[model samples]
Each structure stands twice: as C-alpha cells, then as structure tokens.
Target: MLEISRRGQAMPVSPFRKLAPYAELARQQGRIVYPLNIGQPDIETPPAALAAVRNADIRVLGYSHGAGTESYRHRLAAYYQRAGLPVVMEDIIVTTGGSEAILFALLTCLNPGDEIIIPEPFYGTYTAFSIAAGVNIVPVTARIDNGFALPPLANFERALTPRTRAILICNPSNPTGYVYRRAELESILGLCKAHSLYLISDEAYREFCYDAPYVSALELAGAEPNVVVVDTISKRYSACGARVGALVTLNKQVYVAAFRFAQMRVSPPGLGMLLAEAAAELPESYFDESKAEYQARRDLTVARLQAMPGVVCPRPGGAFYVLAHLPVDNTEAFGQWLLESFSYENQTLLLSPANGFYQTPGLGSQEVRLAYVINRTDLAAALDCLERALLAYPGRTEPPLTTTEVASAFTAPLLTQLQ
Candidate 1:
C-alpha cells in the first residue's frame, strides 16, 4: 500500500472549506445557499486595480525577482511607511499570498521541534502551517465573556516553554474581531522583547479596523529587528484572486532567510505584482467606503445574534467576523444540519463550526464563527435561516443567558466605547 506520510495525515483540514461539499449538494437540490462560513468578501475588486493588469504591456509574463520586482516593493514599502512603519524595498520578500507569507515566516523563524504560542481561536489555518513547519503550537485560549480579547499577558507567560521561539498575533483578529488596542500591543511587544522572541504580526485586516486605529508591529519603537508582518492585497483591496502578499521585516537576516524560501518557489504570480503595485497607489481615503460597509455588516450581524433567544454575541471592536455562542450543545452537528436537513423557504446557510478553530478539545463546541462578508440582504437571510434552524434543531437547549441578559451585558461596554 502506498502510505501517506505522518505529516500529511497530521495537517488539520480547514474548516472554512471542509463543508463545501455539503454546500454543493444544497445547491444541487435547488436550495439557495448563502455563505457565512469563510472570509471571502463579496466586495468587488477595485476597477482601477483590475485595469492595471488588463493594460499591462507584457510580452512575457515571466518571473519577477524573488523579492518581487523592485518597482512593486518600492511602492509597497512606501504604503507601509505612510502608515508610520519605517520600511524600505530591501526589507520585503513577496510570496504567493498572505498564506505563503505565513509559511515563510514560520519556516524562517523556527527550527524543527520549536514551539510558537498563539491566541485561540485564531485563523484556523495556522495549525496547518505549523504542522508543515514541523513546529508545535501552544495555544492561549481567549474567551467570549470579554469579547475574546487576547488571553491576558499572564497567560502567554505561563504557556512559555524552553522550546518557545515566537508569538504570533492577528491584530484585528479573525474569528473574534477583537482588535488589539495600544495597551495590549505594547504589553505583548514588551513581553516579546524581554524574552528575545520573534513576533509575527499578521495585519491582513489592518485597513478594516473600525472602532480603533490600526497599529502595526513595525511601529513599535524597538520592534525593528524582532517583528515580521504578513500582509496581503487580497483582503486589503478585495483582491484575493491576485495571490500577492509580502513578508516584511527590518531584520536583515530574517529578510535574507525568507528570500531564499521565496526563491525556492521560483517567483510570485507576475500579474499579481502589477495589480498589487497599482492597488498600493490608491489613496488612503479609498478605504472609507469599504470600511464603513464592513462595519455596518458587523453591526447587523451582532445585533441580529444578540436579539435571538438563547444566543450570546458580544459586539466586536473591528473586523467583519463575530463568534457567536449558539443555543446548541455542538455547532458541528448544527452546522451540518443547516445544510443537510434544515432550510427556511428553500434557503440554507453555510457555517464554520467554532470547534475546528480551537485546538484544545471540548472548547468552542457551542460556538460558530460568522463572516458578514455578504450584502445586507443575503446576510439577513442567512441569520433568519440560523434562527429557524436553532428553533427546529433536535439538540437545541436554552443558552446560559436570556436574550435580555446577553443584550444588557453588551450595552455598558458598547456605550462607553461610543462615548
């Protein structure tokens, strides 16, 4: 028998797309399925950026420099510098996408058998990437009681083992949408500096930060040598198909190491660089409309969840996701039920089960992470399906708090934030 390598078997399947087959079946059955499962935003790519690639005068779409073309890197570096991060063209290594940049960072920063600590429920693919890098992940679980804020700095300290080589954070986090405030960023950076560990900051959602200003790890006074930022044009400009992302660091050695990995892939997509370079030139004000749109979606998702009986949803500070605690005991079953057996007016919605996002067993069993990337109409429809599904689910139970109790818990903090 041809055997699968242990590493291959060990890679965690992405929850984001694992249920795609179910979605296909629902479509086959003539049910309209709205996807709230993944972060694929329904926003159109900026016309100007698409035009850049369309108008390119290329005779041969050959390989760019492994560090990306000098022109693209220069432009991208300027975008970073304008945001108050001190960077230059030489400090970047362009890769396939933010996903590739993550792989590069993990490979470059840690040795085999090393460990990296991350807060859960993080971008779930981090586990798959760590498995590929031959590193162990020490997860500090964040809770929904306080809106999934980074598990306290003390928790990070306690999880540290001798093999721990780095700490990775997704500011304006994915599953929780809990943007790291100044105090938290500073404290986490101080801890990293004190321990001489590399800090990988995945700022892919920087531009979408709503309630608070986005802060880059690169902006910290002494973060120059210890920080590597994984950035992408995919989420920034709704250009996920472009597959253009960069690994940026002021650490000369780290940049050099990552470049070697970039070279092994030959080069990033050439046309992607063209599109990204043009996107980089877009005005800072370009984000105004898009940001507002996502914030509105976030608000809608949170309010709907909060109003539902037996549901608890804390308003997220930023990002387009809300990790809502459902009235069911296990979300995986409920999620499958949404596609397989349940429907509202011939409609179904796809869900990303929160359990897959947690590496620790038994955690997040009652949760589901919803990405409000669709338009208001589709999103509202999905939530309606969700409400009806819960009522009809065989295993549904009264959640810990009533709708009033959950709504009141969010009122004080939300009011203070607005004031």
Candidate 2:
C-alpha cells in the first residue's frame, strides 16, 4: 500500500465543518439546527449580478485568459481604486476564490522551508494552505479582552526569524472580527519594510466594518511591493457559490509569479467573473444597506453573549463574528454536546470551536467563534439555545464574570485559566 504524503496527513480538519456529522444526526432526529458555525451569510445576492449570468449570450462556456478576463480585470482595478487601493489591470490576477489567491501568494513568495508569521486565532484555512505549500506558520497570540487587537509589535518581532519570508493578516479578521486600525497597519508596514517581508492582507470582510474605518495596506504610502491583498466576492456580494476572487498588488514580480500559477489552474469561473463584474458596478447604497444589516446582527450577538452566565465576549469592531470565551473546559466537547444532546424548543445551534483557529496547543479551548450571518429571528433563537445549553451542560464549571473581571482575566499579559 502506498503511504500518504506527510503534508496530506497533517492537514488540519476544518473547524467550521468538523461537527457536521453531529449536525446531520440532529437533523435526522427532527431538530431545526440554526447554523452559526460557518460565515455563509443569509443576505440575498445582488439582482444585477444574477441577471448578468442569466443574460450572458455565451455560445460556448469557453476558458478565459489565465489571468482572468481582461475586461473584468480592468473593471476590478477601477473598483479597487475607488476603495482607496490604487491598482491597475497589470496588478491583478483573478482566481477561483480567495482561497486560491492565498495559496498562490504562499506559493509565490516563500520556499518550502520558509516561514510566515501571522496572528493566532486566524482563519483556519491558512493553516491548511501553509501545510500544502510546505511552509511554517509562526503565530503571535492576541488577547480577546482587547477585542483581539493586533498583537504587540514586539511579539511579532520576537516571532520573526532568518527564514521568515512573509507576514499575513486578515483585516476585519474572520473569527475575531477585530479590524486593524490605520496606526496598527502602519506599524506592521514599517516592520515588513525593515524585514523585507511580504504582507498578505486578506480583506474578504472589508466592506462590513461597523465601529471603525478600514485602512487597506495598499493605501499606505510605501507599501507597494510588500502588500498583496486577497479579496473575494463571497461575503461582499453574497456570492460564495460563484467562487470569484483576486490577488491584487503593485509588486510586478509577485504578480508575474502568481499569473504563472494561475495558468496552471487554466481559468477562473466564467459565470462567476460575470457576477463579480456586475457586483463591481453596484451602487454604494448596496454596501450601505448590507453593512447596516450585519452591524445590527453583531450588536444583537454581543448583547446576548454578555447576558449569558460565565460568558465573556468583547464587542467586535468589524466583520460579523465574535469570539466568546465560555465557562467550559473544552469548547470542542461542548460544541459536540450542543449538536448531539442539547436543544431548546426543538431547536439547537451549531458553532465552530475556537481551538482550531489557534495553531498553538492549549489555546482557545474555552472559546467559540460565532458568525452573525443569519436574520434576527434565527439569531435570537440560536442565542436562546446557546444560553440554555450553558445552563444545562454537564461540564459547567463556574459562574459568569463581571465586565471588569472578564477584562482583567482575558486581556492580561499572562494567559488566564479558569479557577
């Protein structure tokens, strides 16, 4: 029998879908499961984008240029410029999804033994991508008490080594929903310049910032060669199935290398590109309405989590996610229990345990990342189920902490363990 490659064997299971079997069992047993695990939003896709695909007069669904359709690239560049990222057609290479763009960035910038430093409790897929590329990830842990803000500069500096080749960040981060402020970005930019490292900014949730303004790495004055932005239409336009995303940068060498890899993949999705182009043309009001809806959901989520006994969740500044530290020993086990044993009013909620988001062992065991992507009614129902589950969980250990105790315990320099 042939042995599997070490890289293949080491790929981390998706935190979002790891409990899918339990969810399936619950469904089979006639329970209505409100899925708060994944980041799939309940928002409707733009009518214009759907209509573009419907009205396409394609005689053949032929392969497009490897770098994506030229017309679409031009339009996308303009879209980026409007969003405060000065880009041109030569700076963009459209790909299947933000996932592919990330893989391409890792493949293009670093060799097998090279290392990339990233903030911990990151998007889980980054770990899988690094494994596939045979690269190492050095994580700098960020505290939830501070709303998972960018870890200190000294932490990042301490993590850097001779083999470090890049620094990756997810703005309006996926699980934490902590938006990097302009000052924070500038500090990272300065370090990247000093270290000659590539900065991979995943801006998939760029348009959903609530409390603070988003500052793109591309907007920085001297970040041209160091910044490679990974963007997708999945969360932005509610077009996840379309699988359209792009790698945008002013670094000519990186773009050339990524384009070569793009050729290997043949072409991006055809209909997806059409939808993306249509999405680019949408009025500013589209984003305004969508942002308002997500902000409302975020407010509701944080409020509910705070009201729960032993739960301590910081209000997120952006994105539609919150990482809540629960009063449990292991969230992985608690998540399974939620699906396998718990329900309220014939309803239960599915959640992604926060452990998988951390690369460091023994971190994030007591937390869960909740995506506020559902409607208010469903979100309210899900919160009710979660609160009731905590009350009835067999492993329940402690009472909820006050805001001050929560802050001091979760935000302090040293990692805190529940008493």
Candidate 3:
C-alpha cells in the first residue's frame, strides 16, 4: 500500500461539505431540501457579465499573466477604489477564487507551525487552509449570546504567542452574519499593530451587509502595510463559478511574496477574468436589489426562527447566514435528523452544524448555521420545519421545549467532523 503524506493526515476535512451525503439522502427520499447549508446565492448574475464572456471572440484560449489579465486587474482595482479601498492594478493578484487568495496569503505570510488568530465560529474553510499550510489556528471564542461580535481585545491578547503571524477575519462573517463595527475593527487594528501582526481581511461578503456599515482593515490607512484584503466575485456578483478573486495589499513585501505564490498556480480562470471585469462595472443598483432581497429573507427567517420552540437566532447585520442555537443536545445529530427524518409540508432543510466553526473543542455544540439563500416563502417554510422539529425531535436536555430555546443552556458541539 502506498503511504500518504503526513500533511494530508494533518489536515481536517472541510466541515461544510460533510452535509453532501445527507443532502443526497434527502434527495433520494424525494424530499425538497431547503438549502440553508451553503453560502451559494440564488441571485441572478448580471446580463452584461454573461454577455462579455459569450461575446469574446477568441480563436485560442491562452493563459494570461500569473497575476491575472491586465485588463481585469485594472477593473478590479477600480472596483476597490469605488468601494473605498485605495489600490493600484499592481496591488491586485487575481486568484482562482477567494479560496485560493486565502491559500496564497497563508503560504506567503506564514511559516510552518506559525499561528493565525481567528474568531470562533468563523468560516469553516479557514481550518482546512490553516492545516494545509502547516499553520497553527488560534481560535478565540465569540459567544452566540453577543450575536457573535468580535471578542474583547484582551481575549485576543491572551492568545498571542511569538509564533503568531496574522489575524484573519471575514467581514459580515459567515455562519454568524455578524458585521464588526468600526470601533471593534479599530480595536483589532490596534492589537495587530501592537503585536506587529499581519491582518488578512476576507471580504467575500462585502456587499451583503444588511444593518451596519462595514469597516475595512484597509480603511485604517496606517495599517495598510500590515493589512491584506482578499476579495472575490463569488458573492459580490453571485458569480461563484467564475472563480475570480484577488489578493490585494499595499504592503510591498507581502505583495512580492504573494506574487511568487500566484506564479505557481499560473493564470487564474481565463474566461472568469472576462466576466469579472464586466461584473465590476455593474450598476450600483445591482447590489441595492440584492441587498433588499437578502434583507427580506433575513427578516422572514429571523421572525420565523424566533417563534420556534427551543431556538434562539440572532438577526444578522449582513450576509445571508444566521447562527441559531438550537435546543438540541448535539447539533450534528440534530442536523442529521433534520436531513434524514424531519420535515414540514413534506419539505426538509439542510444546515451546517456550528461545531466545525470553532477551533476549540466542545464549543458551538447546539448551534447550526442557516443560510437564507432561498426566497421568503421557502425561508418561512424552513423555519416552520425547525420549529416543528424542535418540538418533535428528542435531543434536548429538557423534556418540554421553551418558546425559543433558552440562550443560556445551549452548549457547543463536542466534535468537528470531516466532510
């Protein structure tokens, strides 16, 4: 038998993809699964973006610059400027997706066994990426009680070691949909500066804020050299398949290091560059309409979940996710039950269990992330399923369920599973 690399063994399986088997089972059961599991949006891609790719009169598809096509980079730089991040085309290195941009940052900025601090219940892929690069992930806890706000600066200070290399964050975060306030971000900036640490801001959901203003790490101009912004067209333009994202920084050293990493991957998706360039030029109303739609879904989902027994969901500031602490003893098992047996109106729902989001063990055990990617009607129905399932499902410690699960009694999951 062939032996696998130790790095492969060291890596954790992606937590989000673990639902595929259950989702397939749901489909096999002839059940309609409301997909609250993934961040894949249902918004329409701009016609102009599609037309750009379709109209390209290319005789031969050729790889462009390793940093991405010049034209696309220029447009992307302009997009950042419009979003209030000052940047030049040279400051942008287009990658296959935000996923790759993250990988590049890890490879460029961190050495093996170095640590990157992240908030608990963070983007699940961060664990995978950290492990793959042989970096240590220092997860600081942020409770669901505070709506998953950034933890106090003192908590971050407590976790720091000489091995710490960077602080990674997802603005208007995934799972929690908690947008960090300007004050919170400023505090974090001070922490990073004091520690001389790199700040990696993953703004994958930049345009999705529903309730609060976004604070970009780049906005702290003095921190420019210490901050790197990772952006993608996946969520912004609802172009997940485009595979176009950029690693942006004003830090000359970080830029050069990341440029070398980009070369190893060759050019990013060729056709995607064409489409992303067009998407960058889309009218401001594109986001306005998208924001309005997501806000409506958020409103419906929050209201419905609040009415459920043994469930407490925080209304998110932005993005499409709400991390609800279910009354269940084990979210993984409950999530499995949801896919395998539970339903309302003959429709079931899929969710990403919260355990994987936390780096520390035994945290987020009772929480599950719900992505409100569907329309209002479907979101309403999914909430109905949860409400009924909590009443009917037999996982809670208490026999009779509260109107909404008491926030205080809920526990985080014990284990993080590989997908």
Candidate 4:
C-alpha cells in the first residue's frame, strides 16, 4: 500500500490550478473566455530580454554557479539599486522564481510549528509554500471595504504567539491589487522591530501601483536586522516563463541561513539567467510604458464594474487585479456560474473566487477577484457579461438591485437621491 506523509494529506491542492480543467473545457467549447483569474500578463516582453537569449552563444548549456552567474547577480544588484532596493551581489540569491525564493525563505527561517503571519486575501501560493516548508501560516484579516490595506499593527500584534517567526507582506498585493502606503508600511516595520520578527516582503509587483505610492520593506534598513526582501522578474519583465527571481537581504545572519538552502539545489535555470540579466538592463522607459497601459486597463475595468449592480470594486493602486464584492451568497458558486452557465455575446469572464485568497473560511464567500489583464475592448465585454450574469444567476440570497435607476448600490438612499 502506498502511504503519504501527514503534511501531504493535510495540504490542499492549489485553488488556482484546480480551475484549469474547467477553463480548458470552456476554450474547447469555443467560448471567448476573458482570463480575469490569473496574473499571467499579455504584455510583450522587451526585445532586449528576448534577444539576449536568441543571441546567446552557448556550446553546452552547462549549469552556472549555484547562486546564479556572477555577472547576472551583479547586474541584478545594480538594477535593484536603480529601483531603490540597493543590494550587493553577495546579498542576492537568484532562485527559480519568486515562488522558490519564498519556499527557501520559509524553510531556512522557520522550523515545524513556527508561524509566519500573512494578511487575508493573500496570494494563494503562499499557503502552499508555507505548508510544504512545515511552517504554519497565521492569517490576519484585511477588509475589502478598506481597499485591502494592511491590517492594523495591533491585529498583527494580537495574532503573534511565542512561536511566530516572521511577517510576510505582498506589496501591491495579488488578487486585491491594493498598494501599501508609506505610513502603513512604517507601522508594520515598527511592529517587526518591536517583536524581533523577520519581515519577508514580497515585492513582485513593485512597479504596478496605479493609485497610492508604494513603500519597499528594504527602505526600512536602519530600523531592524530581520528584513528579507523577495522579488522576481516574472511580472516586471512580463516573463513569467523566465523563472528568475532573487532573495535579497541586508541581515547577514538571515542571508547566510537562506544561502544554506540555496546550496542544497545544484543551481536554478541557467538560460533563464541570461534573459534575466538582459531584463535587468532594460531601460526604465519600458516599465514606464507598461505601467501606463496597466493603469488604463485598470481604470476601464473598475469604472465598468462599479456600474454593475451588487458589485463593489475599489480602484487598485498597483498590480493588475480588482477584488470585487458581489451580491451572491457564495463567490465560489458565482465563479462557476460565470463559466458554466452564462455568456454575453459568445463571451464569458473567468474569475477567481475571493474565498481562496481569504484564509478565514466563509469570510470572502461573496467576493471575487478580477484580473484586468486584457485589452480595454475585451475588458468592457467581460464586465458586460458579469453584469448579465449578476442579474440572471440564481443564488441563495436576493440579488442586489442593479437597475438603471440606481447608480450606486452601497450608498445611503438619501445620498443616492441627492446625487
């Protein structure tokens, strides 16, 4: 008989990947599905990065250094310096991706039963990585009404047990796409220092802010000795396939500890490093243009969603997602209904239920995450389908009134009348 480890039994499959079969079915049915569920961008990778690979003169595709090619690391350090996340080559460990960097960070920093605190409506992969590394993920809830900002310092402080080892923050958060403000980041930095906790800041979408300014955890250098910054070129370079990222830190002890895990793996992708090095050298203007395009898509998506009945979507400052609170009883069911039952003009929208992102069960049952990863024309149609589905879909609760007469659903009646 085959047996699995206790961790394997207790661990859940990734919620995002589970939807693949259904998405495939829809594609085969010839339904034009707008992928609002994942962050795989449709943007073009810069020619410089692509050219670096095509023009490479490799003879034998040999494994590079375990920590990645020195030239690549050195160039990466310089790139971070330009982005305000100053680092030295020795302080950076180029991993397979931000995902591997996270796993390594957890494995190196935490032992079994040790905990890492994360906010609710987080990136789903974080949960899986924590479990794989035998670390408990303690989630603190952040409200959608408040634009998914960091929970108050007191909330994090209260969740802290003696076994708490680190606080993980995903800036310009996934799913919700809300960017962290300077003051909020400062508050959390103070708490990390006070509690002597390692702050693992995941800045994967550092350049995606569309509203409020972004604050880097690395910027809090003089405050503490436990800050570990995790970053990747996946989203930045529109190179999800690149599989190149880094674990950066100024904390010498933590860096040494993390490096041990790096040594265990022979090396990360070699060809990917060549592309990543060129990506690191991509001109600043490339990012400026990409950010502008994402901002336009976000603006169109939010405005259209806000017009729909029973939907409350806040404009995100960064990232390419919008966490929308819908009128349905369960977002999980609503997501299925969108793909399985309803379509408008032969088009349907694929959404990720907000429940998976929320660690607290039943809390985000009425919410769904919409990734504005498509062009404006496609996004408009997707929003239209969502509006039609909201009206037609049958759920447990009475649907919110989304009639043309009512422009705003959440506002007080008096306010609506005044407007």
Local distance difference test, per candidate? 0.88, 0.91, 0.85, 0.82
Which parts of model 2 have CA positions greater than 4 angstroms off? Answer: 399-419
Best candidate, lDDT-wise?
2
TM-score of 2: 0.95
Candidate 1 lowest-lDDT run of ten: 410-419
lDDT (Cα) of model 3: 0.85
- Candidate 2 lDDT, tens digit per residue, 261-364? 99998999999999999989887788998899898888888887887768999989898899999988899999999999998789998999999999999999
Q: Could you tell me which 10 consecutive residues in candidate 4 have the lowest summed lDDT?
A: 410-419
TM-score of 1: 0.94
- TM-score for each candidate, following the candidate numbering: 0.94, 0.95, 0.94, 0.93
Clashing pairs in 2: 310-400
How accurate locally is residue 390 in candidate 3, as Cα lDDT from 0 to 100?
74
Quote the positional error of residue 17 for candidate 2 in Å: 0.4
